[model samples]
Target: MSILDLFKKKPKVNGIIKYLNLEGWWLNELSDEEREIILNIYSPMGSENSIIEGEICSSSQTQLHFFWGLIGWFNKPELRHIAYKLISKAETFIDKSSEPLDVHFFYSTKLEVFYKDRDLRPNGLELAIQSCEQQIANAPAAATAFKQKYDGNLPAHKGYAQLAIILEKQKRYDEAISLCEKAKSQGWAGDWDKRIERCDKRAKA
Candidate 1:
């Protein structure tokens, strides 16, 4: 079965039961049936850590250990789903705290998760655009933060024009064009005029 097809099926209770049966040392002391029930409750393909943590706090270490073991079993899409949930939870926690660095860390982790996982590349690009837009919206003053972080040159200027292409795909033409202009102004040495002209045509069309 394709990975997508495997994911479409509900995670099998038998699989979890078998795993737990063989690795009972990793679980809190529970009957085989009880472990089966717990697995049934938390065995969904993309189950969130928070949900698992809440249910298994009696032996949270076991859950963590199990995840470590299961890590090899997860395909990229499954990993992406897990990483995204983790990033979302981390963002929420960061928002509730007074730590700006925590927010940055979570966002950075989110980007890394997207970049490292091939199955997530498309979603990662989409998330990158959204993240940049959010950064611009929430702190318009820091619109150049990405540029500053990326060597004082926007992605469009650094031969990473693919970033602009992604923005255009998201229908964020103005932002894409603005990025193209920024790239041109920064002297990163791309055909900025052609890019701007293409964006203009896209905007009009």
Candidate 2:
């Protein structure tokens, strides 16, 4: 029986109660079941624009779920591009916001989504490093937000480490060293020291 049919009948009916219990369990257990049902009913894939809009709607809902659950649903390889697009849009909303906390959450969520899928993107590390630099420049307050979200010193240190690596790969030893030193000064742990040592060796070679 259809989910709606179960809900439509009187709650006192035994059959309706059984169906209601099953429907509730199905909805609660499966994340994509509602989407699947809706897609099956509407079949919007036949239209190109409808398909795009449907994907965006689905992604927005999934992102909200992940944000609330801390589930990292966007980490799935098939959904990476969709997640990226949604995050990019969210960044735009963040840029327009005057509230610091709201802006911080937007950027933090965007960064997490980007970081989780970093290995999948062709230039993910470089993009992440550049994104951090841009965020630092545009929203200095976000540093504190990052720290709160990632624990003390982690945000700055992680971003700087990635920047150092990218600069080193580009044969810019001095710049890499500078970022590594900054990360160290910001209380980055032993790994920052290792990065500095590697950069120093590369510079001398």
Candidate 3:
């Protein structure tokens, strides 16, 4: 047998679930040798091809698992670009598929990352807004995901507030107020009332 045949095959679903149950211990507690072994085994599943642009595949369920597994590396400054690229591909896959609204949370999260990094790519916010709108369109699913999955980060509501603020800045009071109301109804716990009142007064003036 070849040298590659000596290592065990990739873990299955139960193995992944067990690893996740360790709550970040897998990476946080890994020794250099163990880490190297994992990298050698799984890197090809999620890694990009240096020679080709956008060559990473996220079209299948297995690939999505790989993509998500790489998300933990997003905390590392050096590996953030890889995380960004993987999620970008995942977003495209989501756009073309019938994925649930909650799956699009990364649209805002990734945009926030790019914004903080001052590396907003062309159409990034546009994509985020589109995904936010989709979430609003599927209110129940988004709300449940916000409460349970996101620990109440409320990405959809936050995205609406963001768009509302932009509209308010543009003096589009009606649209801004509409979005503010949507955000409020979608469990936004911010000072949207004041903004809505301001929009109302401005719209009447």
Candidate 4:
């Protein structure tokens, strides 16, 4: 409460300011200095934007919208790293959001992140799956939304492919094979047959 105490404390940067800056960057607000600061702050959760949920009532949904924007807006192959950082930056906020996590977006986007730059971080895949499961557990209703969406006659169900590949990597062959079979039965296209074949061979060995 003292004048010296006030001077000693740094002015708290507003979360909205950071979010808006990111938004501006998305809109081609290209300032190298500011962009570098934004990237550094987000890359390591060095800012309140990552840790503290802002007063935005729809914080969770807003974050997802922003992430989707980044994913779509940065479609060029060369911008992959920037896209990954923007997506990764949302992880902590996704975890801390009080609202039900957007399960479909969470699963799909993380899967995209996983394959987009597999070795971006040493434990990225594990963390992605852990976050997916945690968010689902925390927000059963939102999880059920995705479940219902992908449940029946889902053609070329990308979700199955993503989740199965993770299980396959973990050497859970039976689960992976079972998932492929389910997807095939549901009329999904793609390499379900090849995936099943691989999993079967692995299980036999």
Using TM-score as the measure, the top candidate is: 3
Better of 1 and 3 by lDDT: 3
lDDT of 2 by residue, 1-205 (tens): 8988877743221222132233343244334643343323333233443211322322222222222222234545655554565455344434443344445344445556666656777977656766656443434455555566665554343345455666888889888888767656655443767767887898899
Clashes of 1: 0
Computed on alpha carbons, the lDDT of every model, listed in order, comes to 0.46, 0.49, 0.55, 0.56
lDDT of 4 by residue, 64-89 (tens): 55554445434345665565666665
Report per-prediction Cα RMSD to one decimal: 13.3, 12.6, 10.8, 9.1
lDDT of 3 by residue, 92-192 (tens): 54543433443545445554444344335576656555645654565556576457746635543556666677688789999988888877887856678
Pairs in steric clash, model 4:
none
Best candidate (score: lDDT): 4
- Per candidate, the number of residue pairs that clash is 0, 0, 0, 0
* Better lDDT candidate (1, 4): 4
Off by over 4 Å in 2: 1-71, 96-126, 135-156, 188-190
TM-score for each predicted model, relative to the true structure: 0.35, 0.48, 0.50, 0.46
Comparison by TM-score, 2 against 4, better one? 2
Which sections of candidate 1 miss by over 4 Å?
1-75, 96-105, 108-129, 137-163, 170-175, 182-194, 201-205
How many pairs of residues collide in model 2? 0
lDDT of 2: 0.49
Candidate 3 residue pairs that clash:
none
